[model samples]
Target: MTSSSPLHILVIEDNPDLAANVCDFLEAKGHAVDVAGDGLTGLHLAVTQNYDAIVLDIVLPGMDGLTLCRKFREEAMRTTPVLMLTARDALDDRVAGLECGADDYVLKPFALRELEARLKALVRRASSAVTPSVLRVGDLEYDPALIRVRRGTRTITLPPIPLKLLETLMRAAPRVVRREELERAVWGDAPPDSDALRAHLHVVRAAIDGAGEPPLIHTLRGVGYRMMAPDAL
Candidate 1:
């Protein structure tokens, strides 16, 4: 991502004037902004859609900001950077907001420029978390930011699960990745039973292997799987 790249932002504020001002200012900065007037609407959008950053208000009708933020983090498993809007004197609310998972908070009477700067900082942090510097093994390469795979010069697109599987494999390149380890990396604590890991690995292997170059993924008989150049074996 570049400094000029437009970010998709979700602004959940009840005040019309504040919402308009924020949306307009962020829009002027070349960001695509989505506005929700209530916490319910905001929570729905935040959970269902993908946004680069979120500007959330502390109080809203239907649900409070803290509850919404908590649900967004816990239920959705999302780490989208959140910039909270709060009154300066609401010290308790600010503390509670951070506890509920707001990345940073901006005072109600904050300077618009300062708010934008903090948001950009949060975006930089979040981007770094999701997009590794680079992952390479042999002649294969993957850019997590772009979510694209390449061998030599040919680029390929993959579905979300296979893409994640490929990332796990490439990150552990030339080493055997245990089945349980890959499952936990891809599916977390709630992995599917009954050889689901094997099924997904099959798809991932077919996508990254077979056609381009030699097969890089290999089964290790009774143990697990490893990725390596053909000659490495």
Candidate 2:
């Protein structure tokens, strides 16, 4: 799989063998996987961490998948796509999963290939709808086509480099955009210098996070940068 094709996934399954097989298959596909053996732990990770998609089991310890999915959607206010796994083939069971916000469902003993394909579809759907004509995160708004950037009622102006960086960050808002990814988006393989991203990001921070406005651009030090409203933090 290409670097861009790899998705970070969360696997919430109590069955050790099934979990291992699923994890191995997904990892072999160049995806990152995180495993949670119980519902409570799964819910914790689901809320606190970020994942491209989730594979959840219906029957779980501590909390059932239905309750977990409901809490994730209602309480946590997350829109991450969830593909539920269950041994039950009943129509009501499947409906329950969907009613609780699961995007897709798979009966247990499913093919690993099928599982991955479903996840890919879910991620594709989410990514497709992620960006709108006017991208807004908190009070920050960016219109890529119009080349307009604003923080609340205040209009902001930035240099070309910083504007490009801002667009990249806003497009991946609330998700950490790695330093390498930022460099590629703006300057491709030929970034002027090692410190070029840092310098440009500094400018972006200053342009959008002026006084009276809540800071939106955050540096992750060794990791990367993420632009999110304070509530998301």
User: How close is every model to the real structure, measured as TM-score?
Assistant: 0.55, 0.55
Clashing residue pairs, backbone N/CA/C < 3 A, model 2:
none
lDDT of 1 by residue, 1-233 (tens): 55567889999999999999989999999889999999999999998999988999998988989999989887887878888888744445555666577766666787787777767766764554465568887778899876568888778645444566788888888789998888777555645434445545655665677585788888998798888977777
The total of clashing pairs for model 2 equals 0
TM-score, cand. 1 vs. native: 0.55
Off by over 4 Å in 2: 1-4, 130-233
Worst 10 residues of 2 by lDDT: 123-132
**lDDT for every model?**
0.77, 0.81
Model 1: weakest 10-residue lDDT segment is 190-199
List clashing residue pairs in candidate 1. none
